[model samples]
Target: MNIEKFDSRFEILPIKEIIDENPTTKTFVFEYPLGGKPGQFIMMWIPGVDEKPMSVAFDDGKEFWVTVCKVGPASEALHLMKVGDLVGVRGPLGTHYNWGNGDHLALVAGGYGAAPMYFVAREAVKRGCKVEFFIGARSKDLLLYVDKISKLEGVNLHISTNDGSEGRQGFVTVLLDEVLAEGNCDVVFTCGPEVMMKAVGEVADKHNVASYMSMEKYMKCGIGVCGQCAVDDTGELVCKQGPVMDWKYLKKLPEMGKYHRDAQGTKHYF
Candidate 1:
């Protein structure tokens, strides 16, 4: 793996604040000079520990934020980093969601999926698109960014939780069905668990709406060298070709749900 180092000065930003979204999830805000698109992600590095890919939750050009759940070694390290601690960031990489061409945009997000969609909704509203957001989590406490997304213009926010702890008790797909039954949308965009995205894709297909999905994979090198992140069917490199892909193109990947071997040759199901 020929990983290239970015020559620009990488700033070590302090953790400004952490907002607990759920018992297991928290939104961490950091201060950093930003230049990134809505769906792009940054490689977060913890010195002497590990690095992981995290999407920018929000950005004001000078400061940015990321919402993380304590899921693994890297995330655990991130959660332990204090307000004064330093963390390395290397990107804003991957293709961004296209909001310019769509007139009525429908965004479906689940779990931490809401992080990147928050930025996408902001940009869509800024571009004068009628944006409707359908967000879901396990329960009420798992939902994040409700207050912030609600304030954006032209955004119709709908909520759902599996345990009925908040808003609607059904899956987000139910709400999407209602929305589509009521009217039509120009495009549909989503980021979430693979099953969730696949479900959303089916609905969007039925509605004849253009759909886009942000595909998540374990990444080693953020750039396209390591071959660690390859899509099954088309063999496209997620780091180079996309973390975002058209729904139609993604469905064609041969290895979509087959065997994904890790560095140790351990097979994992997608």
Candidate 2:
């Protein structure tokens, strides 16, 4: 395992291609090879619009992808850019998921969380680990990366949609319960909404299985300076110390799902 470092300098990279993942989401394939570890993120800047952190959706040494969901002005600007357009990228930053722990791994993904989880699944499979994916979405239209993940060599995918339009009709955590009960999970990796991750953490705790998750917070500096994304309990910066942490550590955090601070350090309900 090699630790990656960037000079804190930004790179202006051109977008090579774009794939519409859904009505509101798009995947941008970059012209440069950003060999980022799974769960690491890049700071994307759109000139005067805004800059935000996006998880590395796919990275295969030669090419990488950033999956963006149109939620705000910054992401909307990125969605409107043309193929040849260039965007300012400042990282492959932060900690990443670790592999080589166990042979059986369970992935719990909800909504766009599948993006980084897809990256994790790809690398895990190449190491000959058996991956059982539990993907959940609000409905069929919101699901992402199903085609790509299903095509992987050895992956057992179980899906659930809130409306019963996909696999079992329930939250993804429900499927995780079944997998953990079968005594098949060695480690769990999840990325999704904070509420969902908290629930997954609880379940993993009940089974005494090791689980890890990617956390999302309002970030301004992307590096550890502004203190905008610090947890209320430990004051740990998600941009520097984490974004990925173990379930045992995360479950004890007072700010895990209850509240998060904004750029002005205003606390808001999660």
Candidate 3:
């Protein structure tokens, strides 16, 4: 939970603004530094609703935002929230992705995974790194932040969708092959569904490029107190050791891409 920097307690803050990014997703802006790294997440509390771990889509030292997609009950509640409403926020938790200065970065994201990868690309450009950004979703309307990414000077943007609504057709990993083949990418950072991230890791391994992936699980506690987010074999807590993990760490997890646990700790295979 980045315990040294943030405590387990929730800090209540008003929704400074909300911007609809797509039909299914909206960005909630809060006027706080958050002090989150590119791949860090926060547990958001909604009083009677629930608190869910979400990625920090943007954090500019002064304010931060999280992009919420209406996928379930908790997310739906977030979508229903309006400006000036107060919401509880916890740590900018978990380990974050890392890269060297001026390195060429390969950033791949799927669906709402584009949110944090956008943060990665933005920060990378600021460090003078050349970025090759690949964003994927089900269709054109589902793709997030492509316009803003295109405007970034050092970024070369690419898009892919499952139904070919825009850009190339098929999985975003298909485009990763081309970017890695160029032999300029220093590392690959990806997020989204576990299966997609597993595939991204495999591609990175094939190219012998280092890779880091963001993972999600059904967790009751954003802190390590609840073991719900622990992975197979090593028992590394996703709420602590990860949310972001390199291929070396993730490849050892027996359940990677195969199954995940529900809130009740029942295994659900993909």
Candidate 4:
């Protein structure tokens, strides 16, 4: 679809509900019927604060949710706001994770990436796909969606933390590698930090499992018009062509896990 559609335009809506996921993170709910799919994101505008891309955690015809971690200015401002505060939403844009083609799914998440991955897992299990979810965080306190993900049936949850506060003490990738070694997964799905996604993508590629990754990049216009989010070498615009792409295409982009551009095209290495 193109950006000329009405849904691509911003609709200011008040926060209907807010659920605290952690001390520093909360999920904002709105009553809009976005009908968005997993891996697509919404550009959330926090009044005076700039609009930023956010993964749509859940959307079920009547209400939509966005789980935000208080990391940047826009998110910090959002955390300070209360219920009924107005915010602009203009998305469910970008590509979504692949489905229906696989029976057993492996989902990997890191930090706030857990939200988007949970969105996918919810749909995956519903489609009769057995899911193995791997969640990684610096510590238990920093993790997102552990309780919510655990409660879902047909999902085998695996967790890793650097501090050993919750699960195994190591990179979450280690858990994924171990699972892949056992050889039952049909596809791999992931969303999180670029570095972790890169490693996960490599693992999926190694196991010869088809993988879909929800990518992240600095963006302005959610459509392809903006040149701000183009991938180096390949020149694929993250906002238009991706945010979720297959491993075959993702491996072609030289900037996958290395660095990203800012609003002004400044390179920031990850």
Candidate 5:
């Protein structure tokens, strides 16, 4: 028998800076670029804490940033670090969103998902595509990237908060529905919570709009050797084949929004 193995060759780089987006979230900036595209993620190692995959929030050709939300031990450790701290970075790995020739694009984002979606919107608008951003959070305080996305010249921003403290009282999906009714979107892109992505997928399907979503999976080996991020029916690895997949293809995935397997492959309901 023969076997193959390889190392990720992670790089330890110093943090350029950190900007607090809110209490729970902060944007970590690094003076490095792996030529990441929108929707692609990098394995970020916090040394003694742990490593995790984080989506690229901002990449300006010279540097890149990842928006981290301190939800657990590893991330909380990162939250405590200062500007000059060192962290290991592995890749701009996984497939990214495919940009086609579309004039009008609609992006639906919830929670920290705005990071990657904002990246997409930035790149898209730069290519002359008019973007409409539908963003939602639990309340006004939790919404990510509102100020950043609003500054883009031709992009229109619509916001929603669960507590009715923002643009709309319900979900961002309501804005999606309204945008679809206006019949102007050529493509719809969404990221954030699984439930929000699932609902966005359904609405896109109903409106016959081409849609793409970034999936969140419990990734072990970010390069896909561990098989921990496999989507049940498709047998596709999120760390390898996606994080970003078309809505049409994802609708056929039985384990998409229903349940996802843990690191041990135990099914857990979302």
Candidate 6:
């Protein structure tokens, strides 16, 4: 795959701090010039290993951040990067949430899904929209960013863990359903495993609320030219056309609940 368009690079900024989210997950905050939107992602390069897409966990222009769970080669390399170490970054790519039209916005996140949604919630608050966040993880150790997210204004935070280690003892979607049943949401946004997003989409559909979701797929090139990240029915190139898609339209995709192969050709089922 040709990755010329993905060649743009940012200086490797030193990591300022690392906060452990779980045994396998950590939030890395770095110093860098930033211009990213919520739901957008950055292509990170780990010196001789590989480059992968990561969502912006938080950013204040002068300082940028990402929450990475050590799941693979790229992520493990990211975990090894420490204070004052340089790491390559390239992008703020993909579409961001349009909080302009909504009055009450609800955000649903699962596991590392909270990374991108964190920025969305912050931006929504900045735009004067009331934001409610529902976050889920397999266990308490996997949940992250509670302290930081709690500080944002107008955010109603809800959490769930499968192991019942924190907050509610069920899935985050349960809380989402409850919130929707109360009929206070104008729009909904989500990012997580495809299955979780699909479930969230179903609830949003039932409530007739406009919804958007960030799709995660193996992306070799961050631009649209490569067909590596195509969506099921639409064949939409996620690199250029998405990562963020309207839930209503995404439901029409043929691969929604099926299976997809990872970068190393490992099959992952929804």
Distance from true location, Cα of 172 in model 1, Å: 0.8
lDDT of 6 by residue, 1-270 (tens): 765654565667678898887788888887777788888888888878898989888888988889998888889988887788777888888887777734799999998988788888887788788988999999888887787789999999999999899999988889999999999999999989888899999999998998999988889878676677877767778778777889878888878757776767466775
RMSD of each: 2.9, 2.7, 2.1, 1.9, 2.1, 3.0
Per-residue CA lDDT of candidate 3, range 13-82, in tens? 9999999899999999999978999999999998799999999999999999999999999999988988
Whole-model lDDT per candidate? 0.82, 0.90, 0.92, 0.90, 0.90, 0.85
> Candidate 2 — worst ten consecutive residues by lDDT sum?
1-10
Per-residue CA lDDT of candidate 4, range 180-217, in tens? 98999999999888889889989988888888888888
The candidate scoring highest on TM-score is 3
Against the true structure, candidate 4 reaches a TM-score of 0.95
Candidate 6 lDDT (Cα, 0 to 1): 0.85
Question: Residue 172, candidate 5: how far off, in angstroms?
Answer: 1.0
Q: Candidate 4 has which clashing residue pairs, if any? A: 215-243
lDDT string for model 1 (1-270, tens) is 987965633557777888777677778887777787877888888888987888888887877888898888889887777777788888888887886744888999999899899999987787788988999999887887888898998999999999999989989999998897666688888988877888898888888787888877878877787778876656678877778788888767665534465755365876
Better of 1 and 3 by lDDT: 3
**Candidate 2 residue runs with Cα over 4 Å from true position:** 1-6
Model 2 accuracy (lDDT, Cα): 0.90
- Please state the error at residue 44 of candidate 2 in Å: 0.6
- Assess the local accuracy of residue 23 in candidate 6 as a C-alpha lDDT between 0 and 100: 85
Q: Per-residue lDDT tens digits of candidate 2, residues 1-270?
A: 877864777799899999999999999998677879999999998888888999999988788999999999989999999999988998888989987834788999999999999999999998998999989999999999999999997799999999999899989998899889999888889999999999998888889888999989999988998888887688888999778987777778888889887778898896
What is the RMSD, in Å, between candidate 1 and the native fold over all Cα?
2.9
Give the number of colliding residue pairs in candidate 2. Answer: 0
